[model samples]
Target: MVAIWLDGRMRPSTAASVLVISARQVQRLLRRYRESGAGAIRHGLRGRPSNNRIDCGVRDYALAIVRETYADFGPTLAAEKLAERHGLTVSSETLRKWMIDDGLWKNRAQRRNFHPPRLRREHCGELVQIDGSDHRWFEDRSPACTLLVFIDDATGQLMQMRFVPSESTFSYFEALEGYLKDHGRPAAFYSDKHSIFRVSKTEARTGHGMTQFGRALAELNIEILCANSSQAKGRVERANRTLQDRLVKELRLAGISDRAEANAWLPTFIEQHNAHFARVPARPKNLHRPVNEPASRLRDILCWRDERYVGNNLTVSYERKRLILEDSDLARSAVGHYVETYAFADGRVDLRWKGVSLPYRMFDKDQQRVTHAAIADNKRLSEVLAYAMEMQKAAPPKMPRTGKQRTRYEPTGLRSPGPKSLLAKRAERRVAEAAAQAVE
Candidate 1:
């Protein structure tokens, strides 16, 4: 109170007189106020220069290198990149602080101290976060790949990860099938608003109302919830960050190069990783629910789609041989009409005509014409011939032979190189002529 009173404008002598404390105390308080200002009252470290801070130019250089090529890098690795590539002398902590202040970096798996309104799902298999991380997974050894990660929200366990060429409906189908086989289907899948899961298709103001993946999930009775923002489903995104870091290192150490080896090694790696990081039981027993679908139905649930044209004989030729739709309404009505054929991964085909179910018999599936087959032979052959003629016309004219060279030389076919030594060749030719004339 005396210190504050002195600071507020009470005369030093008057403050000492009021408090009965020595004037030296008032002098010390005033000295501290003068030296440290209001910050002194807060206690602990405040605005002091950190011993671990990176030098400004080196920090800026590190920032530039990160921005140019490695912006997604976390601090520790970014620091190593700085040391190796940019020659910046700095620790990870220093780089972290500099980047955090600059808003160029964040700790992805940071733990918050406060509680939120929405708690996690009660069981491990209740909700799973699914996302694809497109990464240079094998670093220099392989081209980039997409890792389709399925992580449980409650237990933070990575259920399955599939390395794919790209993120597509079929890729997810493959991933989901793998996930189901490993841990069974979760009650609901939480994911981003990617077109695969949450596409809104419109056709001249009329809605298709179903994407391929959405339809697949619907058929499987799996509910999908799309998060509006990244933060809403931070778990999988965080997992993507972790996997991108750890998986890259793991692959490099294991000498795994590219998609083939990485994929082959993924199962073993996942087992080891999950063993180390998988969370302990919160409620004792495992919460993963078994798949409810019959094995036959599950087979048809995951597959690609094809389209077929019905013939005049009330039969559809699929996979080569004629698939006679016997007494079939689809065969009778869909004559001269194109019908859709959904080809499951397990090779089962489902045919539908104008949204009506069509019973199909895939007698010779190998001979069935592809739904959207390429151009026919005659058309393609004509196009090739026309292209050849056009290429001949467009090509540059060849340089003509000069004076003496034109008489004996052919231009296009194979030819021997002209002799470098004219005298040696002339003597040899003269000797040959003398021998021929002598024989004659």
Candidate 2:
């Protein structure tokens, strides 16, 4: 995005140069601006306003047509439909903006950044990002399915792999179980705000609680972190995209497609992939160690949702509804039905009551209601994009058509102080947009 922005306008090429971009970029930006105006310069489509956006009425009528007829169509196809039916024409980009403005566009959920997601984790294995991508990973060789991927944030190691339908606690469990069986436990697991990792309404945490996945990590003495921004976990996500492209071919070439066969073939893929792509760490191998728990006990750590509650004394009360109801003999006291405060390996708290989970909360005995000391979440980018289109605060001061004096041009928000620096202005906005995109 920044590269596109810095293209075209001329800037010095010195160390003191405000924009350290290439000359070709300047020409491109200039061509775009000339063709599309400031919109082009801002990376928007350049050219005359779409003939379809001829007037507010046409725009409205076109939108109405879209909402009623081709509502489900993607922007490009919808634009074509508008031209064919209403004889109103507009570029897909223009239609997209109109739909976005009207809140009719799809809202893809994005996992955000660190609690303070800073740079890469300070030490190898300090933060291991785990995520799953549902894709045609085997290309035409196999049916589409999800690949569970665990990547070490510090060293960029592809630590573990598994195949599943959708990314779920069970899939993650099976993968993490394998990881633990091999590499042991890391300091923490980094992930997106998936329901398993997040405190959601469906399974609210006890005033003191933890999610099931969080509980497992806590049991293994590992921390759990959900990124504040999706890009914050770019290590795993970027890897997912890369693998979807590369690994799919490798699988196809090897003539592997069946799910079980794919899974069987993954060990060979991992070894070859790691050998070619893995990097030497700035630090040595991580200090992770396996849990010394018995096999049965370790398997218990991989469970999904289980009924639990808090005791009257504020202690976690739990019962077994699964196979080993009598394994601990504690289920005798816990069953008929009871609750337990779920302790996550990452150390969060989850309180389940009457078979339903509640949101994590902090309560003041006096106030007696739930409260979150931390802010809920950040605002949506669509809100800011909408705000970007607000009309000027006051009517445009008309240039006197009657003016005999040569016109003196004044730049609006596009200029920097003390001098005309279109180059620097573009650079500033370019950087700003990049930062905003990183968070989204």
Candidate 3:
């Protein structure tokens, strides 16, 4: 269009129309092309660096921090940390480009998925998604264990987390206790169809068709919802994935190997994690209800409870152990009545009748299995088996028998052995005489 206009073969208006610009723009470009000879078509700032580009020293510092502290963090998270912690004001996209150029990060191809996204709850504590992740959290430093995660559905905040051996009822009980004390009771708990939360069998002859965990939640007036699939409880499942990546590294950095130390350090990590990842609730109001129940009542509700009938001797058999109730007026009247037995996670058992604790002496019917207080789940099966083998090796060898054992023999058929007593001899002689008379 400019060439036609320069050659005077076409009008500026026609050239402007062809070039998709105004006539004035065509005239301006034509004059510039006359002066600069096609060089004027290039942008003036093409070869210059961006004025808003980050300084070299700042970029170096940010990259150093990423390498040193957050090498595995995603670009967005790394950018956030760079700004918040190191005062490097870089955008996530810019940081991602830089990381890609530096070979510190890679861009992954996006994949289509079938699970639809669910909206967050309206208020905090409206729903808490609970899950247990079995991971080698401590790497090879310690035995693998399960981490119980309690995440709020409304805000995507981690309510509580604990390192346990397995996803057992007792482990959940302990985690629930901590959650109750820390954040009070949530309206409902969201979880999978684990036996701890739901009775999987339809014909299960257990406590009113509810699991121990379900019963405990019912006692606390907290509803338990079991998701049909893992994607249904995706909040906690995703949290587990994040923890398996970040928490494991955190534990490694902190030199923590055991559950006790990991537990102690968990609060700090949770606070930090929530600060970065937690989202604002849709509603400002907190939905968590205060725990109005007394500590004792709460303790009772959170324990493993079973019913046993008191015998005529005022004794109750539990787990093959006899509990002899003290002879009292209450005990005497308790005979033939049903009593409740509460077993706490801390290994304490309380026998109660009509909400009153009964005094009793335990007569152990069998020795209990050797158990470790720190261990909780099957993640440590290998360690437990190794320990058992070691114990067996350390045990004293059994003594060998010295002499052959004798076997008692009896006379065959109707023939009798020689009698040792006078009464036996008389009986034998009478039998023989009767036999001889019959023969004659």
Candidate 4:
């Protein structure tokens, strides 16, 4: 443009339009080009120091203080401490450069581990990401707990939120039950490879590769997808991070220190959060289908279900409890067969055979004792330890089976029956004598 303008082939206005610069600026460039040739295109202040440069003494003093005191601090924090503590005001970027030059800090390029970004589902309820975040939600005021978060992939809206003691199958069942009630049934749920969603063990002996929660979803005709990585279900993971910050502060402000209160308050926070962060879906269609089952039936679907084989005595052992079925025709028929056991959230257990509920009584064993090899997941470790401690306090100190009372078995100083055969013969004689006396 300058050459054309200088040759008078193009007007100054035309050159200005082509270069997207003012006509006067174009004229100035043309004048400089004519006088000094192409070398004039370089900036005049290329090698000059900035006019607002700090004094050498001040720069030295700031760097000295930072090295002596805030050596491990980042540029931004070091700058803040310099201004606050020493009255030395310096921008973070300026300090960053100076620290880099002084070898106190190194300017490192941020290297991001690239992941293939997944596009959001077009319709709402097409995919909902579910996760449980175990955190100190109440800070130091209360014990840490897990928060189950349900978020939509399409709109990024929080579909449901619940605070639970831990990430267990039962906890997930309760949260999912609430979600199904509110939002009906979604096409599918996206989740991490938690055992509640997927059977992690390849050689799992029970449920035929399906988890209890997975079975519930299958029964409801809903699909559940297990993500290979946290980034695959990034929506719920990111929401957990945000809630850890915002929701924790909100709970503190509301003076909520327990799961119950926080759970009751979560609905309002979810609404506000969705209002701020939710996006409009690409396709403005709702893919959620209404559940046709009643609430009672839905609850039945959400509970822990397993099959226990009834013994000859019409009893089934479950969770260290002997379920003694009532003596009836149904109970007799159920013996030597597998009866389905439904354990509900509210501590109710029902025994059913062929869809007929058989009345039963629970004979509890020492289920409360934490066995030597009891395995608890990382998320539930706190709760498990707490309960173990409580049980330890209440239960008697365990005695070794082989520990002797000194050296030998001391006589208990009480009468003992000689033998089972003799006792049975005496009982028969007594009954026969009673029958003869009655006839007389």
- The local distance difference test score of each candidate is 0.75, 0.68, 0.87, 0.90
For all predicted structures, in order, the TM-scores are 0.49, 0.47, 0.61, 0.66
Q: Write the per-residue lDDT of candidate 3 for residues 1-440, one digit (tens) a residue.
A: 67777888999988888879899988888888999988897667899988877788988888889989999999999999988987888999998988888889987743234688889899999999999888899999997888999999999999999998777788899999999999998999999877778777888765688988999999889999989889989999989999999999999999999999999999999999999999999899998888999987888888899999999988898876888999999888889999989999887889888888899998774434334554533545654666566766776545766666546454467865564898888999999999999999
Off by over 4 Å in 4: 1-113, 403-440
Residue lDDT tens for model 1, 1-440:
54557557687778888868788877776677778886664535557767765467776877788788878888889889888987776788888888887887876555344434346666778889999888788887766768899888887888888887677677789888888888876788998887777764555363356677877788877888999778788888888999989989998999988676777789998888888888854565565667888876776667765567788876776656667665666468888887877776555667777766677565554432222344533313433345456655766545666777646855788677776598888999999999999999
Q: What is the lDDT of residue 233 in candidate 4?
A: 90
Cα lDDT tens digits, model 4, 293-378, are: 98789888999999999999999998878888999998898889999989988878888999999998878756657877999988
Model 3: CA > 4 A from native: 1-113, 370-440
Worst 10 residues of 3 by lDDT: 367-376
Sorted by lDDT (best first), the order is: 4, 3, 1, 2
The per-residue C-alpha lDDT of model 3 at residue 30 equals: 85
Reference-based lDDT, residue 362, model 3: 87
lDDT of 1: 0.75
Q: Candidate 4, after superposition: displacement of residue 350 in Å?
A: 0.9
Ranking by TM-score: 4, 3, 1, 2
The number of the candidate with the highest TM-score is 4
Tens digits of per-residue lDDT, candidate 2, 1-440, equal: 43443453434343124456665665676568677776665634455576544688978998898899988887889999888877888999989888877766764442232355456665667789988787877776655677889988777778898887556566678788889887887898889887778766645545336677787888889999888778879899989988988888887788887778888888888888888877766667676876798996785577654554434333333332211221223433444545545544343445444434444334321211112342222222222233333422223433546655457765576745487489998999999999999999
